[model samples]
Target: MTSTADSYFVCATPRTGSSLLLGLLESTGVAGRPQAYFREPGEPMWAGRWGLPSTAGYDEYVRAALAAGRTDNGVFGAKLMWGTLDLVVDRLGAVHPGLAGHDVELLERAFGRTRFVYLWRDDVLAQAVSWLRAEQTRLWEADGEAEPGGHAPGYDAAGIEELVERIGEHNAAWERWFASCGVQPHRVRYEDLDADQTGVTRGILAFLGLDLPEGRKIAPSHRRQSDELNAAWIERYSRESARS
Candidate 1:
């Protein structure tokens, strides 16, 4: 199948439904296997998982990531969080010194015909609440797996407020970078994705110029993590924030 974009990255912040979006895209089997390959702190761990030595150079890491992310049709996908954008770009610069000063060109050199998908939540409060809970619980997704050291998450309005600010800052950074690059990413809102998982997934395939195979079904790999307590936190934050 001829693809419009050879590679794509899901640009996102935490608690933005990125896992769900990536899962839906991956389920199609045409879209690349999107995962967070360049998270700065997790670089060493990812390298280990990819069979790359800890001392592997940046270029080698990129190669492994590309090979791991690409589908049989030669389409590559990855998730790029705002926090790790700088590290990825700086490393890419080392590989291509000539394009060191150019972020977009640097990306294109490594990942051909690259596209960006901006995944975010419209409701900051809800996003913040979800992020705080995930951090405390160590359960980032509902995939029946978890990072080590998980406990029952507790609610704290102050913590939620801090995350709300951080989330906003990260999002703004993404906007600034996009504007600087003059690149308009495909925007996917968490609410819209949650409401119409199949519709949103189809829209992304259409954007990529790939048709979902007839009879292929899209299902979220992870269940929704939010619950009544999450709702209460959001509501409480709204009330407290409004009063403040």
Candidate 2:
């Protein structure tokens, strides 16, 4: 049987393997076309790309998204970073006044029978390292290659430590929000996803009550970015942290 939810949101923090999961889900062809729709910075870009009027309001944008982010079967999906949730909720309130102050209700009103998938990293240190590198190099993915002469980001112990703490705080905030809404999100761990990506994805599809067609393939869009430099940094951080 399929999950009652016709829509789902992937709630995640940076470097939590959410991107990989989204890609895996999209490959199934039955799952919704998940996208980070509500990130404020990406709103205008998406709006213009979707051919919406420059003066379009939140409701119109959301309508466009509902059409764009769904499969033929009508399961809609979106992504939400913890930091972006508050602003998104406020704007959603403008479009749905009666549902304001009730985040889950607001979402259900906007998108029918919504569910949440919480993706988080098990190793904060490793996650922070990845996030730091992405932020510094501005190379979040292999497709977005840098200029030929782009320099590698050097190690910054303090920066990494700060990011680790921030990621924890964001994770905790997500927990609190879930608690406040009496929500028990489907939990996924980055380390587990990395170890057995296909299996993990199958489990999630089961959770969503989605059945991969017989003989359907689970394909990853991109390879993991971890490399020798990541390993070296991990070792250096371990040694330095132990001394301190």
Report every candidate's CA lDDT: 0.89, 0.86
The C-alpha stretches of model 1 lying farther than 4 A from their native spots are none
Residue-level lDDT tens digits of model 1 in 120-169: 89998889999999988888887656678888888798899899999999
Which residue runs does candidate 2 get wrong by more than 4 Å? 145-151
| Residue 91 accuracy (lDDT) in model 2 | 83
TM-scores, each model vs. reference: 0.95, 0.95
- For model 1 the local lDDT of residue 64 reads 94
The alpha-carbon lDDT assigned to residue 78 of candidate 2 equals 85
Q: Write the per-residue lDDT of candidate 2 for residues 1-244, one digit (tens) a residue.
A: 6766788999999888777888888888767888898888789878988999988898888889999999888888889999888987788898989888988888888888988899998888898998888877877776656534445788999999999899989999999999999998899988888889899888878878888878889887866887888778888998999999
Can you give the lDDT of residue 25 in candidate 1? 94
